[model samples]
Target chain A: MKNKTILLASRPNGVPTQENFAFEVQDVPALQEGHVLLKSLYVSVDPYMRGRMSDAASYVAPYTVGEPITGGIVAEVIDSRNPQFPKGTVVMDRLPWQQYIVHDGSGLSKISPDIAPLSYHLGILGMPGLTAYFGLLHIGDPKPGETVVVSGAAGAVGTVVGQIAKLKGCRVVGVAGSDDKIAYLKEALGFDEAINYKTVGDLKEAMAQACPDGVDVYFDNVGGEISDAVYLKLNKFARIAICGQIAYYNATSAPTGMRVEPILLKKSALMKGFIVSDFAQNFNTAAKDLVTWLKEGKLQYQETISEGFENIPQAFLGLFSGENTGKQLVKVADREG
Target chain B: MKNKTILLASRPNGVPTQENFAFEVQDVPALQEGHVLLKSLYVSVDPYMRGRMSDAASYVAPYTVGEPITGGIVAEVIDSRNPQFPKGTVVMDRLPWQQYIVHDGSGLSKISPDIAPLSYHLGILGMPGLTAYFGLLHIGDPKPGETVVVSGAAGAVGTVVGQIAKLKGCRVVGVAGSDDKIAYLKEALGFDEAINYKTVGDLKEAMAQACPDGVDVYFDNVGGEISDAVYLKLNKFARIAICGQIAYYNATSAPTGMRVEPILLKKSALMKGFIVSDFAQNFNTAAKDLVTWLKEGKLQYQETISEGFENIPQAFLGLFSGENTGKQLVKVADREG
Candidate 1:
């Protein structure tokens, strides 16, 4: 069978461009024993994908030149040689920007449509969901009545973090780029307060007014100036879980790194960095809990889906501009999410 | 009777000078009921005193000019109207630095000489001892067979940290100044390894050699290049307890604007600053344990005694140059170890 694929052509210096990615027409080889054939149902385009495009060492392996870019995707198994995965079954696998994939069923996970949207697994009930789950609960450790300040508050991870903090009895405050996202963050996602960082003149004062008691747990997904300002107002013995630095990830060399020793010294605070891969052992527990949260309507998700394999690059680029509220995904074939 | 006292004359710039201190003799007035006339026997010279000399804010209150400096001291009650503390009952008190203090018996803990030297209550059995106890156990939280690196390892707190870590089954590595101090750290303090930072060209390389598995717990008394280098070698989830930054205490301003943000991001480490005052509630338990350890010969202590109350300023200034080993103390009158 014929397949369409998007290959990483080069590593970009700053924001990735079309020049760094190339489209390709390839053959889908016959599946061997205990294998299945997958037709791409939903292609997940995420901000974390930007890290995989670079050669720098990170939590996940970087994509090499000429290799297909891979991310979470839901697919329909058209043919199967494995007893566990049957024909016409819907499954989730690390599918690249490809039309079809022949897999040995090793990395594929079966999914139930009755659970939620197939695309939601690419978001609220999938990796992004689990990322927010463990990152907030394990690292944030939000106590009842404590204040939680989350950067990237309108994004996939941030949205979940705010809601989870609320569930845990914390006053949830979010920082985002646009007013619309902020509105959605506060109104839709049940956040206590949302600050449009782009519109705010004095972020420190604004954050202070919102969080009068000071932040006890800071869920930092977007690092840089926003994180810097939050670092100053941290309460004594505050816990900061460093999930990602999407804001600073694109810097060519380094940012004008401010001094953080004062934070540790004055407040006796703790700052920790982690990737979800470290918690792979408990991925099931995290994913199951996330799914339960979504099915119960306690968790909400939003995705900006770009149509066709041709617009995958644009969908990936939307992440840098904060154009997507939750997860950004690319739709390849007929599938209702 | 006439009593002499040393007062904080002015806030210090960089390294403190004699000009920052004022020595004056005041006439001793008659004590009232429930009051005692006590003579200061030995005064402790500690790095934390530098913070008190600065008018700037800190965890502890800064000392004001024209006010007598107060810290750990061993005193002998000359005359007691309180009836609680009799004459010649050696005790520890947080009184103004003077040859004689005429005040009510408050915040004074009577010391038993049968336990150890009276001077040790000002060193191993007092605030420094508790600081090491809590900072290492609760903050640093070292585990069995883990590599522990302690800066200023021959100093009062550092010596106790090494001995305690040794008892905890950790491989204690000492970083100190001079060959003699290094020898003392290894042979006397029971540190598994000692690195003379003054002679080592590259502290990071030396640390790597000493702790091949990487540093687990770092008890930092100095916060300069050596501490920064040790930070680079921190293993995953390492804990650093910032006891005192004696290295930068003498600077006119703060640090020469060197960014210390990497300590948080790169290592995913925890750096916590602390003052012994925060652990006042645990004073009794810590004192009993330390006193027992000393009597059982599990712990050892050394005092660099600079004779006379007149040399208190000199003794404090010497801390910046690493001139003293173990605890630095000044004998104001007839005092015995």
Candidate 2:
């Protein structure tokens, strides 16, 4: 059988386009003694992946050209030479953007269909969930009666952050790009107040109205002007968790905004930047808590899935445009027994 | 007897001048039942005092126009009606810029002459000493073998910070203004490395060479371009203690510079701004530890005393110009028995 894979054709200067990716077809190699042959079911497209596309040194290494774009993928095992793997088993791994993959079980976790869904393992039960969990609890540390303001509030991570802040008995305010997202956050996710940042005339004023007591904990997913405005409203001893900077991710050159240290000094605030993987040691506890919250209906999750393996690039590109409201993913194939 | 006082003649637009203060001579008043007549000896002038001169709301209330500028003052009680304050008692209080004044002992701490010099109460054994103690130990938390970089290294708090970091067994680097200050930091204070930020062409490159292992803890006393340079060299999970921002204290408008969140996010670093008073609850232990360190010769202290009451404004103005190498204090009069 033949396998079709998408490779990074070229690194884009600014925003990525269809031309940045190329597809290749090759015969699927037979599994080695410790290898398992798998067919892709779902692939996660995350904002952090934007950092990998660039050559600049970051927390993670840059993705090389002519290599398959790899990320969190859920696949069903069809053939195996290892005793640990059997046919019909589902697994999650850092797999390439391809119709089929061969895995050695390294960095692979078996997915149980009884948990939630296969797609969830790519999002709420996975990276996005852990991002919200640790970033809020560990960094933000929202106290009861304290106010929390989260940017990118309608996105997968932001939505979970707002819900978790509410569960901690904090007054939660959300900022998003669209009116639909604002409504979804307030009505569906039970956000105390949500604002459409694009429509707001003055974000600082809008934030002031939402967080009357001033923000004590800010879980920031979208940085730039939104964060600058948030800095102005920070209360004494406020904690800010920097999860993502999606606003400047696609910019061709470095963006300059407000100098942060002066304001941080004035307000005696704390700001920290981090990635989800930094808390890998605590993932097991976080996943269990997430599962319990999911069962208790205290945590809600959403996804924007595009069908077909060919649409992987499109789904990833859509993140910059704010086209997807939730966890953006691509469905490669149907689940099989 | 006549008492000489300096009142705020006018609020400064940016950098304070002699015109901002006016001298007044008034008759010393008799002590009331609960009050003691204070004869000023030594008064402290700090960078944080500049914030009080402005009308903007901050950690401390704005100093009122035409009122005597009040701060940490060490004085001797000449006449006392309050039984608790006997004559010849050396005390510390938030007193005014005056030669002789009356105080109620509400915020007063009786200073024992047996402990240290009378001027020491306004510096190393006083507020500035407590500031370096809590800010570095609590916020920076420099672990042994980690690299600790302190800005404004020749200044009062900065001097102690570098010494304490060394006491903690960390590699200490200092950024000062003058060559003399740099010499003092390396030769006298035993700083591992000292950089004259004013003379350096590219501070980032200088910092790179000085801290080859990268900066793990940054005790930031002077903010602005100097701080921007420090941010570039932060290692992953670095902790920054924002004790002061003297560089931007005199700015007429907000200064904009490089955005910090992206770098912070990439490095997973933590930056916190704080005033020494935030750790008021732990002051007793800190002060005791500081005294112990001083007695054990592990901690060193320095003072820059300006003679006469008239030089108070000059001493304060000197802070912006980097004129004083250590804790800046104005001596009004000698202790009266």
Candidate 3:
């Protein structure tokens, strides 16, 4: 069988571009014992993928030049020598941006379509889901009547975070880049208030007006001026969960903003930075809770999926431009039964 | 009796000077029922006092103009209407910088002279000591064989923090502005490593050399470039206790530095800013442990006494210049029996 893969042709100095990627066509290797053959069905293009494209030190290892870019992928088992992953099994694996992958079944996790759609595993039932789950519940520790303000509210993690805070009986406020996202967060996601940061004359004033009571927990996904304004209105003993700094992800030089030490000291605030994998040990518990919420309709999710194997790079790049309204995914091919 | 008091004459824009304080002579009021007359002995001069001198938002309320400067004072009971505090009884009180004060015994805490020196209550046995204890044990949570770095290592709180981390069986590194402070931290406070930030050509390189194993727990009393260097070496899951930001205490304009969100996210680190009062519920427990350590000869403390009530402003101003090695106190008068 033939396979097409996207390779990292060059490292990006800042924002990644199509010039940084190259295409390669190769033959899919025959599955050995304990191995499985996967036909890519859906590929996840996440904001965090931007971190792996650079050579800088990060939580995960950087993708080297000439290697295929790998991330979360939902695939169908075409062939299996492993008993655990039989033919026609739908699974989630950290696979390369490829049409087909021959895996040793090491990191392959079997997915049940009965739980939700197969594509949901790459989103609300997957990494993005677990990120919001642990970051909000464990780190945020939102209480009833407390106010939760989340950045990137229209995105996958932010949408879930705002809703989770709402379910916890909190006053939920969201900050996004566009007016449509702001409307979606308040109208569709049931957020108590939403602010379009780009349209607001003064973000601090808007945040103050939205949160009559100061922010108790700030779920920061898009760090920059938006976060700077949020810090100003944080209540005493506020908890700030630093999930992503996507605003500075594309900066060529060092990023500078309002110094937070004085604000943090005055408020006695707790700012913690973490990736979803940091809570790997508790993934099962979090995943179970997420699945239950989705089943009960307590949690809602949306995805902006681009079509074809070749658009994976574009889908990943679109994240910086705020082009996608939820989880951004690339549909590679149909699942083979 | 005539009493001399130091008042906040004017708010400081940046670093406070002698002109910011005003001296006044007032008639001492007769002690009412349940009140006692206190003769000030020793007054503490702390970096946090700098914050109170400025009319800015802080953990504590700003000192209004013409109000007497109040802080930790070691005083002797001169006369008592309240039988609970008899003459010659030594106590620690949040008293103004005055030669005499009549107290109603509301917030006054009696100190046992046998535990350590009477002046020690304003240092290792008082707020700074409690700050080092809880901020380290509760927030930093240093474990055995881990690397703990403390900035402002020769200051009152920083000295105690390094010693406490040592008792916890961790390798402790200290950073200070002067060579003498660095030497005192290693020789007197038992810190395993000491870095003179002023003398070091490259702070990041020096920190890398000193903390070859990487920093596990960081107790930051001084924030700025020193903290920036330490942030670079934080290990995964590192905890930073932000006790004080003395480095930016005197800045006239807004302080700016490298954004920490990216580094913190990559390391999965936790940074918490706290005042000693945040752990008030646990102060007694921490104080008991601190007193025990002092009695056991496991803890050592040194004080730089600036003699006379008139020298209180000078003592406070000296904090910015790094003049004092350990606890800086102004001796107001001789202990009266």
Candidate 4:
């Protein structure tokens, strides 16, 4: 039996293209001792993966040419060589962009199908959930009766940050790329206000109108005018968690410019940055809390699924274009529903 | 008796000048009810005063035209109308740049003559001392053996920051304008290393050599390229207390373009801006600890006394020229000493 796979053919200078990735089918190798055959059900396509595709220095190394692109996945153990696991056990793990894989279950987490839709392991209940959870709670430290503003509010992580801010008794405002996304941010996520960056005539005025008391906590996912606008409205002792800067990711020229120093001085605020991977050791505790929140319906999450393993790279590329309104993921195979 | 006085005549566009002040000779006013006639001894000249001169809006209100420029002072009550303060009592308080002041003791903090020299109140045991205290301990929380860097290290606040960092068991590096100031900072403050920014040929390489184990805590006083160079050497989770930006005080045009997003993304660090005034509420506790340290000889301080109340405006202007090494103060009058 053979499985379809996607490999990094080349590293793109700027925005990635289809030419940079090559699709191929290869026969599945026999499982060794303590190795389990994983049939990938869902493959995650995240923004951080872009940094891993280039050879430039980052927290993690880039994907080598002619190698499979690896990331988060929800897979099912069809054939097992390990004594601990039998056949047909479902799990969430980090693996390559392929339909099947043989790997150890050490880092793989068991996912109960009765609790959640298996695909959520690729998004809200996954790393993005923890990103918003720890970033806002630990770094942003939003207080009750305070105003909290989040950039990239329609994205997986940003969406969770705003909702969590609301749960913490904060007035939540969201910034998104499109009108529909903005509406969903407010109506679906319970954000107090939503800003459509595309149609907003003046960001500063819009932000001022939305956050009258000034922002007490700013969870920054999109770093550009959105971050700068929220920065101007920070109250005294405000805290900002810098999650990501998607705006300058694909730029071939120098990065964008903004005068942000006066904001800190004016408000006596703090700006801290971190990645979810930094808290990898505490993922178990965060997962338990996240699962409870999801089951209780206190937390809302959305997944934009693209069907078929052949369309995995296309789904990945769509992230930069703002094509996915929620967690962008690809479904490779069904898990016996 | 007639005495010299310098008052804030007007606010400046950027760097304040003599034209922005009014110098005059007036008879010392008579004491009123519950007020003491103080013979001004030492008046502090601080960088934050320049910020107070601007009306563009900040954490504190701008100084009004034709009013006494208010800051830290050490004075002697030659004539007293209040029973609480007897005649010939020495006090540390907020007074104007005048030979004498007759006013209620609203913000006055009395200083015993047995304590260190009265001028120390304007520098080490006063606002600057409290500023360096909280800015380092609370914001720039350094662990023992960590590398800490302080800019403007020979200045009033910067000197204390370096010394306090040393007491905290960190490898301290100070960045000053001249070799003399650097030597004073290293030798007197027990700074592990001192870098004269003006003579450094390559800032990045120099920082790398001085701080082989990247900077863990940065007490920033001068912001600009020096700040940019320091940002390059910050370790993961570094903490920066943006105390002052003496470098940008004279910026007549827009700041030079540069991006520091790498510090945020790569290091996962925090940068916080603070005013000495913001930490005013905590001054009592900070000063208590500071006074004890000073008494025990664990903490040290220096002053650059520019002579005469007539030089008050020029003394303030000299801050931009780096004329004063440590705490810049002006003697309004010598009470028959």
Candidate 5:
């Protein structure tokens, strides 16, 4: 069988381009014992993947040049030598951006299509969901009646974060790039307030107006000027969970902004950074809560799905430009029995 | 009897000078039934006091212009109408910078002259000590074989912080402004390594050389370029205790520097700012450990005593220039029976 794979052509200088990724066709190898032959159904393209494209030391290893770029993918098991993952079983795992993958069934997590859609495992029911769950609940620790300000509030993790904060009885305020996202966060997600950062006259003033009680919990996904403004209005003992810095992900040079120590000192605040995997030990507990919330219709999610395997690079690049509303994904192939 | 008191004449524009303080003389009022006549002996001059000199919102209420500047002062009860405190009893409390004070004795903490020196109540056994204890043990939580770096390492809090981290079996590196302070930290305080931040050609390079294992815990007493350099050397899961930011205390305008969120995110680190009072519920536990360490000779302290009540303003100004080695105290008056 013929398989197509996307490889990291070169490390990006600033914002990544089409030249940074290359596509190659190869013959799919036969599945070996204890291995599974997987056909990609849905591939996730997230802001965090930008960190992997660089050679910098990070939580996850950087993507090697001329190698298949790997990420969270929902795939159908077409052929399996392992009984644990039999044929026709849909699973999710960190897999390469390939049409077909030959993999040992080590890290593959079985996904139940009955609970939600197959692609939902790549988004709200998967990494983005887990990231928001742990980062917001565990780190942000929003208390009832307190105000929560989440940047990039229309994106995957940010959407879930704002929703969870609202569920926790917090006054949820969101900061996003577009009016559409701002409206979606406020109208659909039930956020107390939403500010279009791009359109706001003065972000700091807008944030103050949004959070009248001052920001008690800040779920930071976009770190830069938005975060700087948030720091100014932090209430005493505020909790800040630094989940992602999408604003600085594409910067070629070191990004500089307002020093936060003095502000944090004045507010006696806490700022912590983490990836979702840091809370892996408690994933089952979080997953249970997340599943229950989704089932009860208390949680909502959106995805910007780009069609075809060839559009994966463009889909990923579009993340930096705020092209997608929620979880950005690439639909590579259809599931087959 | 006559009483002399220092008042905040005007708010400091940047670095405070003698012009900001005014001395006033008045008649000492007769003590009330619940009051004690406190004679100020040793008055503490802390960098944190600079915050109150401004009208800005802070953990402590800003000192009102034309009102007495109050701080940690070890006083002798010359006359007392309260049964709780008798004549000649030494007490420590946040009191006005006055030669004589008619206080209600509500917040007075009785001090023992035998435990250490009377001045020690303003340094090793007082606020700075407690600040170091809670901010280090509770926030930093340095483990054995870990690398702990403390900025302002020769200051009262930093000296104690470095010693405590050493007691916890961690490799301790100190950052100070002067060669004398650096030598004092290494030779007198038993710091593993010391960096003179002012003299160092490249602080980042020096920190890299000093903390080869990377910084696991950072007890930051001075925030500025020194802190920026320390942030670069933070190891994964590093914890930073933001105790003080003396570097920007005298700045006329808002200070800005390198953003720390991305660095913290990349390393999965934690940075928290706090005043010692934030952990007041656990102060007794910290005091017990601190007292035990001091008696065991495991902890040592130094204080620069500026004589005369008239020089208190100059003594406070000296702190910004890093003139004091450990604790900075002004000897107001001799204790009287």
Candidate 6:
């Protein structure tokens, strides 16, 4: 058997191109003691990956050039050398983008395939799901009847954030790049109001019209002009959860925007930036709540799955252009591969 | 008896000038059943007053044109009709800038002069002191051995914030404009390091050198380039307490600076803007702690008191020019009146 791995070819200047990634084909090594030979099923492509590609100091270490890029991946244990991991067991772990990998199973969690679709683990039941869960609930703390305005509201985490805010009885307003996403968020996802930022000539005015009561909680995913507009409408004691800055990820130069401290001071507001791992201790509780919501059909999720392992780079790049409406994942192989 | 009252003559275009204030002389009215005739002892002039000079929406109501500008004041009750407030009682209240006024002792808190100087109620034991206490202890939450950087370090709130952070066993670095203020912070207040921002060629490098450990708690009072420099040195899970933005309080145009969301997100940090009143429920506890510290000689405060009531406007204008150190106030009259 052979394994195919994708390596970080070079650091990106701004937006990553295909040249930044390199593919390698090699023979799959035999599993060592207490190890399992896994076959990749689904690989997640997220906006946060862009941050890791840079050498700047961040929560996660930068991806080293000429090293395999690692992220959340769902895999099947095709061959196991330890009793802990039997063959045919499906698991999810942060793994490198590869056709097959041999792992010691140190961090792999056995995921039952019966609860939801197998791909759902990489989307609604995985990192993106938890990102939305904690960032919105723990940080944003949306109160019922309060207005929640989420930027990049059609993306993976944003979709879940809007849903969760709605579940908390908040008036949800979504800001996305496309009209299709706006319609989907309003009609399918039940968003109280949706603004297509690309078409909205005056985003501040659009946001004002949507959130008449003023924004109380802001779940920021795409930070830039959209967030600047949202900052203007923050009510007294507003809470802002800074989840992602996808809009400025590709900027070659340092990004500058309106000064926020004055606005925050005037409104006596709070803005916090956090990652899902920060709330790792409460993952079980969040997962249980998410699963309960999923089982009860009170929560819905969408995935933009691209086929073929070779198309992973394209799927990741698509995120910058707002090509995906929900969780963007690439299907590398079938479960029985 | 006659009263000299200062009114907001006109809204300032940029930095307020003495021309914006109007003085009117009138007879002091007799106290009503629930009112007290108070003689102003000391009137505080803080940077936050600039926010009220304009009609912009803020945490507090804007100072109405042609109306008295109200702020923290130490007064003596000369004649009291209310049993709650007797003659010779010294009290602290948010009162209008005036020499004498008849007020309904609604918000007055009797402050004993036996504990400290009567003006201490307007400085270390009052609004600025409570501001530093809550903004640092509650929001900043500086842990032992953590690095705390306070901007506008020699001012009323910044001075107290630094002392408190030191009491919490953290390394405190102060950023101020004048070398005199810097010397006072290091020598008098015992700050670990102090930076004279006006003379410092490279503020960011100076901060990096002063705070060898990256800043963990930022008590931001001056919110322009000084804060922009501090934002770059934030460590993981850093907490920024936005107390005041005196630097940009008089900006002719809307201020814009480097975007902070990406930096906050990368560092998994928190930045909150608040006034002292946000933590009103815990004021008594904070006051008790402050008083204890003062009694124990663990805390010391400096006052920049301009003599005579006529110098009130000059004292306030001097704040922008960095003329005063510690709490800036004007002496209106003696305690006995």
Best by DockQ: 6
Please provide, for model 6 over A163-208, each residue's C-alpha lDDT reduced to its tens digit, 9 standing for 90 to 100.
9999999999999999999999999999999999999999999999
* Chain B TM-score, one value per candidate, order as shown: 0.96, 0.98, 0.98, 0.94, 0.98, 0.98
What would the per-residue lDDT of candidate 6 be over residues B1-337, giving only the tens digit for each residue?
8889899999999999999998989998867798899999999999999989999887888999999989989999999898998999999889999999798888889998788888998989999999999999999999999999999899999999999999999999999998899899999999999999999999989989998889999999988889888999999999999998887899977789889899999888999999888989999999999999999999989999999988899999999999989999999999784
lDDT of 5 at B83: 89
lDDT of 4 at B78: 89
Residue pairs with backbone atoms closer than 3 Å in model 5 (clashes): none
Give TM-scores for every candidate, taking all chains together and pairing residue i with residue i.
Answer: 0.90, 0.98, 0.98, 0.96, 0.99, 0.98
In angstroms, the error of model 1 at A286 is: 4.6
Query: What are the per-residue Cα lDDT tens digits for candidate 2 across A1-337?
Result: 9999999899988899999999999999978999999999999999998899888989998899999998999999999887787888999988889899988978778999998988998888999989999999999998999999999988879988999999999999999999889888988899999988899989889988988899899999888889888888889999999999998898887668877787888788999999998999999999999999998999888899999988999999999999988788999899779
Candidate 2 docks at the CAPRI level of high
Error of 6 at A232 (Å): 0.6
- Give the Å error, residue B291, model 6: 1.2
Output the chain A TM-score of model 4: 0.96
> What's every prediction's RMSD, in angstroms?
3.1, 1.2, 1.2, 2.0, 1.1, 1.3
lDDT of 4 by residue, A1-337 (tens): 9888899999988898888899989899988999999899989999888888888766678899999999999999899998666687888877888899888778888888887888887788888999999899989888899999988899989888988888889999999989889889988889999998888999999999999998899888778778777877888999988888787777665463654565587679888879888887888898888888887888988889999999988998999889988799888898752
Task: Determine the iRMS, in angstroms, of model 3.
Answer: 1.0
Q: What is each candidate's DockQ, to 2 decimals? A: 0.39, 0.82, 0.83, 0.55, 0.86, 0.87
Q: Compared with the true structure, what per-residue lDDT tens digits does model 1 show for residues B2-21? A: 88999999988788888999
Residue-level lDDT of model 1, residues A39-118, one tens digit each, is 89889887777878888755568998999999888998888898988888899978777888888888788888888878
lDDT of 6 at B289: 94
The superposed Cα distance between candidate 3 and the true structure at residue B265, in angstroms, equals 0.4
Of 4 and 5, the candidate ranking higher by DockQ:
5
What residue runs in model 6 are displaced by over 4 Å at the alpha carbon? Answer: B30-34
